[model samples]
Structures are given as structure tokens and as C-alpha cells.
Target: AKDNRIRFYTIGLGANQMQVDSILGPITVNAPDDLDEKILEKLANESGGMFFRAKSAKDLTRVYEKINQLEPVKIDQTYLQPKTPLYPWLLAAAFVLLLIIRVIQWR
Candidate 1:
């Protein structure tokens, strides 16, 4: 981790809970279109972050205001992920299917 300092921000626009699940995990919201509340929750839960939604050009100004109001902070995250052989398996499956098709044609 060079410098060991980074900030991660997740933005969900007109997105349901499932869309944000992999990024933010489980979260409950009343409406998918409401950006204010969703951004608010994300900021609050993610270490005093900033939140805003742009419903229009005027709303864009408000979003900027929210960002300006938040104090500077950093978030550090680390996780373990395992790798599996994917491409080789797919190639093997395709090879088997081609062989089956060739045999069928010969029948």
C-alpha cells in the first residue's frame, strides 16, 4: 500500500439496493429515485463522508455544498480474495461441445 492513504466514494443514481449490494453491502432505502436520503446514509455510514443528489441543475449546486461542508478524512480497507481457474475451464467446455457436435454430424 504505497502512501497508505485513500478515500473511496460510491455513487448510486436511481439504483436499487441490489445494485449497491456488492459495493456497500446491505442497506435499506424507501425509494430508489430519492438521491438525498441515499447519499446522506452513505456519507453517515462511511466515516462522516459527504452526500448529495442532483435532481436538476439547481440541485447540482446543493450537492457541491454538501461536499464542501464535510471535513477531510481517510478510509483504509483491505480484504482477502481468492483466485480460481476460469478461462481454462471455459475453453475445456467449448472444446467438449465442439467434439460432441462433430460426432453428431458424423452419425
Candidate 2:
């Protein structure tokens, strides 16, 4: 979001509505686990996009092919780095603790 040279093209996300913008649900039926289909639908319509639901391998492939055919979005991905330098240390501590416990029990 911070990048000025980027456009977002989110697709097939279960959390979002797949209204007119999606390429999977509008034309076909999806599986039971298809989450937030209505939301995606609403989002697509609101965003002035198309929505599609791919229930099978062929449909899924078709969706991808369709997506590829669309115009390219001009945006660069923002590289996010973790602020916690202690993350690696925490992992090491956990491994050492487990090793010490196993060694003590082996005696």
C-alpha cells in the first residue's frame, strides 16, 4: 500500500466477496468450502469488475487463462522485513530447551 507504483489485483481470496470482479463464481458453481462468495460478488460489482467461480480443474485453468488475458496492473510489491531480530534467538532457545530435556531424561 505504501508503494506508489503498484496496483492491487487480488484474486480468488475466500475472505473477499466475488461479485462482478471475480472470474470464478459468476459463471459456475463452486465447492462447499468456497468462503465469502457473496462478499466477492459484492466486491466485484462495487469495483466494476467481473467475478468467476471455478469448480473443476478445467474451470480453474480457464480462470487462470482469463486472468492472464487481462491487462497488466502496474505495481511493485513492497518488501516487508521483520522488525524482531530476536525471532531467530527465540527459535534457538526452544531447540536448546528441548535438547536439554531429552538429555536429562536419557540418564
Candidate 1: worst-modelled 10 consecutive residues by lDDT = 1-10
State the lDDT of candidate 1 residue by residue for 16-83, as single tens digits: 43322546685665455545676566654565343444544565666666565554446568667898
Candidate 2: C-alpha lDDT: 0.62
Q: Best candidate, TM-score-wise?
A: 2
Cα RMSD (Å) per model? Answer: 18.0, 16.0
Distance from true location, Cα of 94 in model 2, Å: 57
Candidate 1: regions farther than 4 A off: 1-44, 72-107
Which stretches of candidate 2 lie above 4 Å from their native place? 1-34, 73-107
- Tell me the tens digit of each residue's lDDT in model 2 across 23-73: 654543333474666777766656555577764567678777876777455
Scored by lDDT, model 1 comes in at 0.57
